[model samples]
Target chain A: MLILTCPYCGVDCDETELGAGGEAHLKRHGPGSTDEEFESYIFQRENPRGVHFERWRHAMGCGKWFHAARDTATLEVFGTYVAQAFEPPQEIKDKITAKRPGWTWRDVA
Target chain B: MSDVVTALDGATFNGTIAVEDAGLTGMITLRGDFASTSFQNAVTGVSGVNFPGKGEVNSVGDRGLAWMSPDELLMIVPYDQTNAALAEITENLGEEHHLAVNVSDARAVFRLRGNGNVIREVLAKLTPADLRVAALPTGRVRRTRLSQVPAAFWFSAEDEATLICFRSVAEYVFGLLRQSAAEGSEIGYF
Candidate 1:
């Protein structure tokens, strides 16, 4: 029963009203790249227990996509931002850092 | 040309709240940035009702508009004036980046009327959205799931509301409303 507010519609929606779009902000490696690069791009994912960023679609509401930064274990949603953002805003990162201290985002972020 | 017809042909159901098809309403889906003067002026210039704020619906009698999304508006006009209004909106927008299309026949509208909290109770059954008077007061619109289907509804009066859904799901939504509003189904939570 996780709830996330849609940055686009400004409505707080439960998981039932939204569809998860998997991990967000993945760098795609296209043709000419090495086989390992392509493989990592397609299959690799971070399964951290703490603060994670993901894409979600407000399927039942405004029918728009947005990003959510939350804890994978506790389900505490730190913040939601527009889908077009290349990365989560500084405020979201700060919130995550404040909630889960020592969670380095330099590599993951 | 064939005469236009509503999906349910003016269906009606009487329960705790009266639910009935609102007949054919001229609807246009206008998608564009509200920040643009041409976008704002074009729609307001033809819709009678000015551009509404987030999740707001501005309607007076036979005409109005609903804020459908961050960049979309649903213009409600007389059934006969949809195309004309769309044409006028397009002309006004000129070369602006926008989309205005006649969507009157692609959807269905319904009216629910009752006293005090009955309308709210009837709607609270199907969706997770807060439908209390204070949250969804008259002139405000909410777009959310009505059961498993996507729908949008607006409170026109304290005791009356209008709902809109895709034409294909008119019967499904009508049935859900009927069952939720059944005489013995009052939840009294609102």
Candidate 2:
């Protein structure tokens, strides 16, 4: 069972205690955006085999949603941050870079 | 007039473990900034127990507070004293960004006690939390699922725990507990 520490409640919640909220930090493309942009925003997802950012809610624990940076293949979570964050924190990026050198997620290099 | 009865009102079971309804305890879900001095003072005034930190439980006499989350606490008091406690908390908090909800009827509580290893064995099957004394200890509260159902539990003593779950699934939770306890007896768990 994967355990992720909830930043709000300080509990290392088992996966059973959490609910996956899909990709994190997606900029919503609404009415003003073109059809392609809207489609990408709603339907497109990066199911990369390496580093990925996702949203998770501590459903059974704190009931707060948070973000996690993890390796999709290994399921090794690099870090977890509060949901209010717009992007993965630099320290988390640095940690991921240190482990998997030359890895880049989206525009955060 | 219709009489209201709890899910476990007439239910009784005997085995190596003992389980019983806590019986209409007053429960309030309080949400606010835990670091706020006013919030702390208000809660202490009402519950007589200081506000607990994350995963902690504090009690003074029968009134108690269990930290449900970073900004949430579950207040437990005698069923008859719920209104008084609620009023005291609401009055003292003043205008803080806070919420006080009477959730007494939304939950069902069960007290469990047994000899060595019995409680541990039963809970181990249901939760991933480490039930050992070194990890959980007394006064540690855990908000986690018991099997597939969401529940909150705390160690009241080394050999005792209090389990609270939504009233809707109280019977199912009780059934699971009874089955586990009975199975433990068969295997000489304690």
Candidate 3:
């Protein structure tokens, strides 16, 4: 029973209480994008060896998107934090803001 | 009535003891740096009960009380006593970065005695508290879970321990207890 700390819930609960979705930072194509683009996004995955980003679900408590850093080789989870509710660093923010819901890249500040 | 639900909507079985809506008790969750003198004084002034302060219970003339945690405590008293307790507490500390939350409405407590040992076994299957006398010696409190419910389990008296649940989930919790008990058997809990 591994005690995984939830960034949002702020509790060290059993891993059974959570479900791993997949790698985080997986980009999904927008509606106007081509089918090929979406397919690549859906099927392709980067199986990193260390410090990989992943998405986890809080099955027993509040359901929210949270990011975590895990070492692939050791399976040691270093830290977990809530997903950015707003803007992030310049690079990631630019990419995300470009494809945000209801707004195009040009629409974001 | 075979199944008597209390005023708080908690179901009370014929064999189990129930004390519902006993009084509007005030439960204040206190959190601050444990090593801070201000925090210590804040607790003392409010309860007149010295901070057993680290991880234990300290009583104050049967009214004000403090139950400790890792870095926090739960101060409980009669509802009417909160204003005065708060007054003395704030007066002593003046200004500090601490939390004093009134969680009175969030919890419902039960006096689970008589067959406590049996109940403890039933709970051990789901909770993490070690009910063994050696592990959780009498008069001790341990915070753990009940299925999915977060609870504070403690021996409140010689043969009694209080089971507190969130107000919104009290009814569901009561049902869970009834289902866990087998039919045609006695609740011979120690």
Top candidate on TM-score is 1
lDDT of each: 0.87, 0.86, 0.59
- Model 1, span B43-116: residue lDDT tens: 88898777798989998779998988898899999999888998898888888889988999999999888875
Candidate 3, residue A38: Cα displacement in angstroms equals 23
- The reply for model 1, stretches above 4 Å from the true place, is none
DockQ of candidate 1? 0.66
Please say which candidate is ahead in DockQ: 1 or 2: 2
Q: Count of backbone clashes for each model?
A: 0, 0, 3
Tens digit of lDDT per residue, candidate 1, span A2-107? 9898887777787888989988887889999999989989999878778888999999878899999888889988999989888888898888878788785427
Q: Of the pair 2 and 3, which is ahead by DockQ?
A: 2
CAPRI classification of candidate 2: medium
Interface RMSD, candidates in the order listed: 1.1, 1.2, 7.4
**lDDT: worst 10-residue window of model 2 chain A:** A1-10
Docking class of 1: medium
DockQ-based class of model 3: incorrect
**Location of the lowest summed lDDT over 10 successive residues in candidate 1 chain A:** A100-109
Runs with alpha carbons beyond 4 Å of true place in candidate 3: A1-109, B1-11, B16-23, B60-68, B181-190
DockQ (C-alpha based) per candidate is: 0.66, 0.71, 0.04
Error of 1 at A14 (Å): 2.0
